[model samples]
Structures are given as structure tokens and as C-alpha cells.
Target: MALDIEQVRHVANLARLALSDEEIAVYQEQLSEILEYASSLAELDTEAIPPTAQVIALPGVTRDD
Candidate 1:
């Protein structure tokens, strides 16, 4: 999905950013690319994956006086 200049401008307005024409163009491209990449991640199949609190495997810590 391509983002239009007006959408970018609206985002900038919401963000309170006073972007110049050049900056708006640059940000529009970057934001669009980032969104596209994030969208691609939605294709992952995680039906058999288990949810965990942490990525690194570690035992719980304990303290004794």
C-alpha cells in the first residue's frame, strides 16, 4: 500500500511536525517502506508456536539470607 502525500501531511500535522517539502517526501518514503516491511511480517505462520515471556532461556532467580 502506497501512502499519499496528503496522508503523510496529515500524519505530520497530528505529530505537530513542521516538515518541509523535502522532509515530507523523505519521511513519506521511509514510513511507507517501514509499513510495507511490517505488513510482510503478517505472513508468518505461528499456529504451533508457544508463547513465552522471554526469548532467552533462563531459570528463575532466588535469594536467601
Candidate 2:
């Protein structure tokens, strides 16, 4: 699932950005790593755990830690 230069270029174009070829290549690697990390997290096993509303301590929402 390597992010290619064309995809990066398209995203830049949609955002009205004017990135050079070097910048596009750099963003491609960074974005690909981000997506891969998210994909890995999706594979975690947490079926027996209860759901919480908040990850941090808030006024009313439950805390995960």
C-alpha cells in the first residue's frame, strides 16, 4: 500500500497547493506511514473491553486510562 507520487500530487491539487516533485515524494511516504499505522490499530483485539466516551479526564466523559 505504498503511496505513490500521483496520489500526493492529486491531493495537493485538490487543496490548491503548489508542491514541487520533491515535496510530493516526501508527503507520499509520510501519508503512507500514517495510513499503515491506522490500519494496524484496526486489527487490535478489544472485544471484551467496555467502550468509553473519552480518552482523557474530562468533566463528565469516562476516562480510558
lDDT of each: 0.91, 0.89
Q: Each model's RMSD to truth, in Å?
A: 2.4, 6.0
Off by over 4 Å in 2: 60-65
* Cα lDDT over the full model 2: 0.89
For model 1, residues 1-65, the per-residue Cα lDDT tens digits are 67889999999999999999999999889999998998889888988999998999888587665
Worst 10 residues of 2 by lDDT: 54-63
| Distance from true location, Cα of 14 in model 1, Å | 0.5
